[model samples]
Target: MVKIARWNHDGGTQSGFVDNGNCYALPAGQGVQSLLDAGLDETLDLARKVTGSATPVPLADVHLLAPLVPATIRDFVAFEEHVEGVRKSIDGVAGVVPEWYEAPTFYFTNPHTVTGTGEVIGIPAGCEDLDFETEVAAVVGRVPGSDGRNLTADEAHRHIFGYTVLNDWSARDLQRREMKVSLGPCKGKDFANTLGPWIVTADEFEALHDAEGFLPISMSVEVNGEAIGQDLLSNMGWPFAELVAYASQDSVVRPGDVLGSGTCGSGCLAELWGRNGSKTPPPLKTGDVIRMTVEGIGTIENSVGERREAVTRVPARSRPRNRVAPVVTAGT
Candidate 1:
């Protein structure tokens, strides 16, 4: 089913099934990896056997880490809403490129970087325009080219370890500046990528995802208890199979590698930041709590901070203050 790792009242960590208060240990201390390493039939059989022995950690009590801490995080720009939203903000980026329309466009991210759920996220100095990106990430279990060939859709299905929610934090200013040089989103995206509360396996929600591995997941972001961006996973343009096919072109996709559905159209400040004709997107200030949720996946609640600085100077890009930097970066 939905396998997860957690800490208990005694401060001991254990791997278990996610249920309704306390986390009970799985007989073998196996988490999602165990299932991922298992074959398709074996995984499905295990799913039918394990009744959850654990309880839900009050969203605040549990700390969420990246589902797999992958070696590479590849974010795909395959959502039309995000494509259009980018166009609405920048003149030349409005329409989807013909190639992008036919195939998924993706980029690699720094796998070593990460942030846990409920942790305080600091805004990098000089990045006056930081933003959030709501997305669903797939954790890879099997590496491609194991048998001298890349993984096919069927192989890909068996290789998926689990799924988790991700918040691809963005520094719009830095991202734009870096892209202008034709290099890549080095400093912009490498700073931090928020992931997890738990890793929900593929079998747990068999009915949730379509044949192509595109699950109809609902997502939302709340700031200071107010709803900001929300949408369903159905809005995605390309399915996971297409992405896998694209990613495996002439190369291999590996285990613990992450494939992210780039920001769902309205799931960012650039899209939902302003109202009425003004472009003032409110920036996140210190002490502001942001709760990002995905139905069935889980919610990750984090507070904003400035590390050693005072809370008053932390920048936020919300409505009425849309002075946030422009959205001009490409995939990843």
Candidate 2:
């Protein structure tokens, strides 16, 4: 398996394969995205050639960056246990909605907010209940001349380049308030989404898939150096292929696009709080660190930074008058 990464070394950014605790640099200006765009087979061939020809650098010497700046991000609530747990916590409900079973549901998140492992994530202003969601994400790869739309599950599976550990940081207070209007988790989620220690190419997991195409890989999370929860990827209601295909329905997905496997069962503090009917595992705070790991992929660890004060406030507006008045009958 080839583990791909981008890092800062010798005062500049370099992209390469990481193996045996060493980084083998690709040629100047060539990055993981470029290799992906070149097609998967070629990318694998290049990985071999580059690692063989380049001088190795100690992995600890450089600072790693997010594996790639995603072209788009679509995060899905693919785990049934997560949905049920969170629904119970936030709404005082005990079960998932039927619509969730009909299709894989996803929301587009801010790709611009993507950060690397080891980076500090800041709490948004006015957010008291900060949280972390442990997940696995698939990075899309391009096939030459492909439109990347309305794909079959098999086709979508083939288009996946690699997978990485993800931390979808949340502001629960803001999320609850905004979602009351039934429109958003926007401001609540836009702050940060952490990806990487590095990306593990998808081919590495070929032997791990079950008969149903679900991966049984173990996933776990930690906070402030204490183990929080663990679950298997097989618990997802929909497979990664189905989630990718659902994202492409009547739409387009480009290379570098990311599809997240939402929070795994017992993957977040919010879910645990709901299950226990109390805040057993409390919300994250400034200076708290979160570490998440997927079996085949490496671990991603990040510290929470201080929350910033809001510079401007948005005051509530008065309700608007109805544009159409009721009409009275002539007899009345």
Candidate 3:
């Protein structure tokens, strides 16, 4: 298996692969970004050269960072069960929207907030009901394509670089408020989204495909050592390729972009608590540890840290005001 990753080395971060409990840097002069920039063929060739002959470093010696900073993050809600559970958790909400069945729906998240496994994530300020979402992500590669044309599922599928586990952390309270504004999720999700342990190249999962080419990997989640959620990647209504194809409709999917699978059914505390109503565990807080594992990719664990000091926003009077309404005038 070609498992790619980035780890702390020589006071800096470097990209490499893990093999037999050890780590080796990617062929000299190459880092995770470079590999992504190399596109598919060259990246694959370089990955193949990381053999047992290279000097190995104890995996224990390095702290892993997010495999790579995603150029863009397109998180999609592709699982019906997750939608149902979420609706039930919040008040007076119905099940999935009719549009959801027509095609995959996604939102772009703050790529700047991405982190890796083992990192300590602080709860976003003004957020109390912080939650963690468990899912998988496909890394978008820079496959040759002209702008303005959409790639079909078959064509887009080839643009997949690999897969990684995702913990799209959320501030439930903030998310509720923002989503209610008739817009999509923002600050509530912008703080942090964990990706890693490592990236398992797509070829490593070819054998795990089901009839529709959906990867049927078992996925599980645990918080503070307590098992909470388990499901299969196959539960997704729209597979990664379809989602990728839809996302690339007249848009560019650059290398290192992330296409998330959203949370699996029952894969998040909000869904469980919402579905069960008060019987589920409390929302995650400082010191809470969440561990999410995927059958082939690997596990990513993060500890919730104390909230940071709040930054004072510009006072209303001093801030720029909204556009002034047109002056009232006669019909003339």
Q: Between which residue pairs do clashes occur in model 2?
A: none
TM-score of each: 0.78, 0.95, 0.91
Output the lDDT of residue 213, model 3: 74
Best by TM-score: 2
Comparing 1 with 2 on lDDT, the higher-scoring candidate is 2
Across residues 215-235, which tens digit of lDDT does each residue of candidate 1 receive? 787899888888877888878
For candidate 2, lDDT tens digit of each residue in 220-305? 99999899989999999988988888888899888899999999999999999889999888888889999998998989999998
Candidate 2 backbone clash number: 0
**Which candidate comes out best when scored by lDDT?**
2
Name the weakest run of 10 consecutive residues (lDDT summed) in model 3.
Answer: 140-149
Clashes of each: 18, 0, 1
Provide the lowest-lDDT 10-residue window in model 2: 311-320
Cα deviation of 71, candidate 3, in Å = 0.4
For model 2, the superposed segments whose C-alpha errors exceed 4 Å read 311-313, 323-332
Best-to-worst ranking by lDDT:
2, 3, 1
Question: What overall lDDT, based on C-alpha atoms, would model 2 receive against the true structure?
Answer: 0.90
